[model samples]
Target: MNTLLLIEDDHRLANMVSEYLQQSGFTVQHAANGLDGLKVLQSTAPALVLLDLMLPDIDGLEVCKRIRALPGALAQTPVLMLTAKGDPMDRIVGLELGADDYLPKPFEPRELLARIRAVLRRHAPGEATEATHQTLKFGSLELDRDARSVSVRGDVCDLTAYQFDLLWVLAERAGRVLSRDQIMEAVRGRELEAFDRSIDVHMGRIRAAIEEDAKAPKRILTVRGVGYVFAKQQD
Candidate 1:
């Protein structure tokens, strides 16, 4: 069973979520605060982190930032944020901080479970048979599906697991203009939150990593009023 580290302060909510997830076949380690969560992370590597945006001590956004600063592969650990606020900005900020996904506080247990599964699937490597087409190239940019790594001109690029998947989806269908709905559909392989504009934020993050100049992105271009397309030719 996959393990999940939940950094939430509400005792009642925590216990309920823990019980719900446990019933779904996941092992959950709960931390009441951000520091404790970091401590737990240091001792154990969970498949993913379920972070609450508001905490008694340090906020979840700060925790997410620190997680990304961790050494090596640990920094790439998938994060699914829980936001009590209905503000779209909170979700956008979490996404900017490398969160794989986010669900508003009043979320149904079933939706939460589905979201967790989807995030985990994105972080995990594809099936063994897909290894034949594992590495994708676009001039200087290279993506290794098996390694879940991206590099530009042999130099590695820093990207969240979710961002990498988004880029990979576009790259695999290079030259095709994909609507935001289509892109998310292809990436998740399941129904998700409707065509959220936050996808633009993720695209910006991906370009900042792999593109020499995010201002003049060449690899991924927006078609205006439509969606984005990964360029076939690159230099």
Candidate 2:
């Protein structure tokens, strides 16, 4: 059974969600505050976490940061945020803080369940085995799957987990162009909103990190009306 630690201060909602998830065959553990949630996570080592941004003690973002810093098998566990805040900025911040996905408050139970399943689908064991986890190189740029890290000319660069996933998707498909929607779904594990520019925003940051000069980028080339391509490396 997939164990999920759900952290939410709203007792009624927590109970409802916990019961619903349990019915869906998930082993659900509930926490009423961020600190307790973190403690549960450390002790129980759940498969995933469902975190609410508002909590009685410490905010969910802090909990996420602490989890990201945790040593051993817990560090890479995916977190799916549940927040009353529906703003795009809030969602982006959650993603930056290592959240795998976010479901706004007033969410339908069905939608929440779907998001949980999607998260599991994306990170489940044997999923990425479709391609070997070996490092891939394009000129001076190297993507190290084993390290879950990237480097440009031997210098490791910082990237948000989302950013790293996006770069990896494009790099692995080097020379093949991917549409914005396709890229968004592959990287974010969700479809993009009509007005959402989150993918573009992430792409810009990625170019800044890897391109010699983000302003005059030759790689990550833009193809108007289509999308961006991880421009093929030249010998």
Candidate 3:
């Protein structure tokens, strides 16, 4: 069973979510505040974290930043942010801070379950099972499918699981301009929401991690009205 840490302040909501997730075959751990959540995170090894944005002690964004700053494997752990705030900025900021996915409050349990599964699938191991440990190289950038790691020059690029997957999809189809809908379908196996900008947020994060200059990225180029394309030329 996959262990999941749920950091939520509302007791009733926490109980409901935990019961639902537990029924869905996850080992759920609950924390009522950011400090407790951080402590639990340090002590337990969860497959994923369901972080609530509004915590009594410290905000979830700070917890996310701290989580990403952790050393080794702990740092790369997938996070799915939960928020009551419907602001696009909050969702963008959460994704920018290393959240693999985000779900707003008053969400259906089924939708939440789907998001969890999608995020977990993105983080699953044996990604190169059919590729035979292949590594793609573009200039100084290196992507190892087996290890699911990306490195620019000789240094590792810090990316969340979702960001890495998004980059991989674009790089694998280098030179092709993928519309947001197409990209979302390819990456998430779902249609793009009418006004959702999560993909753009994730792309920005990916560029920041791998590009020498994110402001004028050469690797992942924006196509303005259409979408984005990963440059085929390395040099």
Go through the candidates in order and give each one's C-alpha lDDT: 0.89, 0.80, 0.87
**What TM-scores do the predictions have?**
0.95, 0.79, 0.95
Q: Write the per-residue lDDT of candidate 1 for residues 37-76, one digit (tens) a residue.
A: 9989878889999999999999999999999999977788
Can you tell me which runs of candidate 2 are displaced by over 4 Å?
127-135, 144-165, 185-196, 201-226
lDDT of 3 by residue, 1-235 (tens): 3999999999999999999999999999999999898889888979999999999999999999999888878888899999875677888888999998889888999898888898898888764666487778998999987788899878988888778778888999999999887777777634425346788888899999988899999999999999999998876
Better of 1 and 3 by lDDT: 1
What TM-score would you give candidate 1 relative to the actual structure? 0.95
Worst 10 residues of 2 by lDDT: 187-196
Report how far residue 98 has shifted in candidate 2, in Å.
Answer: 1.6
- Candidate 3: clashing residue pairs, number: 0
Error of 3 at 177 (Å): 0.9
Candidate 2, lDDT over the whole model: 0.80
Q: What would the TM-score be for candidate 2 when compared with the true structure? A: 0.79
The parts of candidate 3 lying over 4 Å away from their true place are 127-131, 189-195
- Candidate 2 lDDT over 69-138, as tens digits, reads 8897688788988877557677777776677778888888988988888777666544245467678888
Worst 10 residues of 3 by lDDT: 188-197
